[model samples]
Target: MESMLFASIKPMLATVGDEPFDDEDFLFEPKWDGARMLLHKQGERIEAYTRSGRRVTDKFPELKEAALAIIAEQAVLDCEGVCMNGGRAVFDDFAYRLRLGDSRRIAAAARSHPASWIAFDVLATTREHLREPLHDRKRIVNECIEPSERLSPCAFLMGRGKALYDWTKEHRLEGIVAKRRYSGYQAGVVSADWIKVKHPVEIDAIILGYRMLPVFAFVIGLHFRTVRFKPVGLVEAGISAEQRAAFLGIVAGGLHAKQEGTTQWLKPALCCRIEYRDRSDWHELSGTTFKGFLPDKRVDDCMWTY
Candidate 1:
């Protein structure tokens, strides 16, 4: 493993689990609603990359002080890049920051809508090849990284997943993650050692198509096995007028569009994050609501669960 090139490595992923449990082997924490990022700090230079390996360091300059937050010669930290609004993480604010290109605009936006890095695990400085257990690695994070307004440590409870899950659910927070105490970090790997349970429901799905006639709603679906998309149902609520226009312009490029009756079919190119009450069936999504566009996710990332 190349120690310094950790920016190229993908962040480890969590698999969806059925229910939360109180187990001594697992440490549970609130699952953040934002993009996954891996922060690399070597000497005076710090770099931030999305789970897909896209460099987003310049996009949120307010976090530039993050380079000095880590009190170490070299380190690679797994963090969640989040924007807060009214005490809750807001994906729309974070997405808006990620889409900017101009430095002046980005700098100005950073002040108006700032993002923070919440460190959960330390990989490189804890050990080479991530051989250390999660408990020890997290200890390194708590000690090495000094907390600031922009960078802070993630909080967790030992053997109390069910309690945290209930609280998050009651408050309508994102959800909770259960990580094995002795598990080692696995870059780019989605393992059972780490489990994610959402509050009610929220998952990534592909925009199979859309219909504009009676009302504007997205025909959303998820990837099932080898199938590209398994159409679930239409997501009608929570999409702002600005969001509607923005998504329409991008999919209308003629590069990923097809017409089937009144519905405009689209190639499996656009992905969105949505929250629904539940899956009434294999094809129906109850109380489906659009969260926002997840640029960090691919079509394959929207895997079906049934």
Candidate 2:
């Protein structure tokens, strides 16, 4: 039979309350700091698929080798390939490998910073497509992928709304994702079956100030409000001449540094998005920036949390 193709999408749930897992409701898993992929193995052949459904077996030879080495006769998996160094995920390091397309860099990356698989779902383990309820799929995944250094099961905190929320915050995990225990797997976008909660809301703020460095142009700050134009935090800006030029291009007539009252300030016109770890003390930022600016969003609508 031709290899089956599984949808690369899965529902990501939001946190409700910090509720504890009761025996009947839901299962939880660890959120991996890695790229998501679909793993397929049949006989001696193995392959990986990107989120866009592109075949990426050749791009991750190490992972392909792991799949082939599995003693299972045939299987399909939903997993993430995280490149870890000293127990921390290094997205930049993996990105560098992506930029270097040749086999040499691929081999070098494998040796210097290898990728580990975090198996979360089992699409197929026996000959049938387990399009059954998500709860069952998770159970089979746990049974199939044993805990090893290279392969570990994702742990989740399943419970009532408030308890799970508390656990998520206490653990400093991304946030608790609440899922309806009976939902079936749906291919495409995020399903209503799941929900997520992140602390320290993210927001879009205006660029208000910056600190210039010899290595870069400026560490940009953002404004929390336009009418009041309150200074929030700074984003590491102007990393390169080209970056400085780009930033200048984005902001009208570049930048001019001066002081406003007792505060050192830059023009509050440029906008940026930033994510924070918490919002308990949103009112004050004694000696810090608004958090970190996210380049993927607009300045006018910087994400914010209450």
Candidate 3:
């Protein structure tokens, strides 16, 4: 029983062009549209856990039902917990589901907006630990189960780097992840086995003030400052906790007057490389983080234009 517990680890990401390996040499998996879930079953009792170590079994009744119906013996599999509404992912549709504590609501939502387990990697089966080679474990999971209305394997494509990148863009998918064909699973943080090839999206923007979230510490903003930082956009995707701390320390007391409406203005001392999908004439825009500045990228580089 102890040997069957192979922990699944998160993948590490590489910058757009840093240490890029040949795509043909790596396995490419689709970036799923869901939350990371770990499934562990022992006898008649089954448990579903979130990546953050929280038990979410009650929140997803459909998954619970499917787990009981299909799984055999003791096994651990890494998958994405996806909620399907009208045959497509609504992205943030599961927000209410997580917070919902009522079992009746859970059942109703399970029937209305069902959840699917998109299996990506299998860590263990019975007493055998398949973590040593990803290719072997993937084959075990791929051949063991048949696709159903609620379960499917993650999509994969094999090609050169440029071809895969082009395919991601054509499908409007997030990006392709590159993983070594043979690498063991290592738990906690990002592991060395994986590298991501994502569309390079960047923009030069001035840092406005910061809005502090309770748990997230601080969130930065980007909008034209001449009329004051009137809530044009936010930065959430790329900036790390270390960068957030450093940025907050740099602009600690540079808050200007609340402009245009109720938004606050911050001193323009930072310029960051932001990635987004929308590129339009300025009035308002939506984007997330991609990468950030080097210590050498000076504040003089940030200037806004209409």
lDDT of 1 by residue, 203-243 (tens): 88988899997889999988665566889889889999999
Ranked by TM-score from best down, the candidates are 1, 3, 2
**Ranking 2 against 3 by TM-score, winner:** 3
RMSD of each predicted structure: 11.6, 11.9, 10.2
How close is every model to the real structure, measured as TM-score?
A: 0.69, 0.59, 0.63
Clashes in model 3: which pairs?
A: none
- Candidate that scores best on lDDT: 1
The Cα error of candidate 1 at residue 121, in Å, is 0.9
Model 3 per-residue lDDT tens digits across residues 254-273: 54535433334565555666
- Candidate achieving higher lDDT, 1 or 2: 1
Model 3 regions more than 4 Å off: 3-21, 68-71, 85-88, 128-130, 159-161, 200-255, 258-306
Cα lDDT, all candidates:
0.82, 0.55, 0.59
Clashing pairs in 1: none
Q: Ten residues in a row with the worst lDDT in model 2?
A: 280-289
Model 1 has how many clashing residue pairs? 0
- CA deviation > 4 Å runs, candidate 1: 201-306
